[model samples]
Target: MARRYRYPFNGKRFIGNKNSMEVHDLDNETKNCQIDEIKDEHVVTFIPDTLEEAHKQGFDNGAYCIGNSRR
Candidate 1:
């Protein structure tokens, strides 16, 4: 068996070496967990492209909404 990684462009991959780690797409079991983790951060919406950038944007948007909600 072989662990295939995404191409070196806009793809993300799991971290591991040969005979050590298994590199595969996010499984269904862990998908919910990941979603839960992000949801815990109060991220109402996020882009599916990049977590770091999109999450930051979501956080910022959340903050803005919170700050202006009373108005």
Candidate 2:
């Protein structure tokens, strides 16, 4: 099934939760990422559609989805 995004702001490859401030790879998200678990109010779509942009907004790489090794 195709995944449906809430904001889909810039159609970026990454998705993040405002509540947790964690960003995940939309194409490679794992079950642990819990993209579906995030509330609609917490869902965030980056404007620039880049990891750096997300980071600039205080979002961090998802430990489960975006690789834990990289901070």
Best by lDDT: 2
Task: Give the poorly placed runs of model 1, Cα more than 4 Å off.
Answer: 1-43, 58-71
RMSD of 2: 2.6
TM-score attained by model 1: 0.18
Give per-residue CA lDDT, model 1, range 1-71, as digits (tens).
12223322113322111221112222212432232233222322223433344334432212211122211
**Residue-pair clash count for candidate 2:** 0
CA shift of 61, model 2, Å: 0.5
Question: Residue 50 CA error for candidate 2 (Å)?
Answer: 0.9
Candidate 1 collision pairs: none
lDDT of 2: 0.74
Q: Weakest 10 consecutive residues, lDDT, candidate 1?
A: 15-24
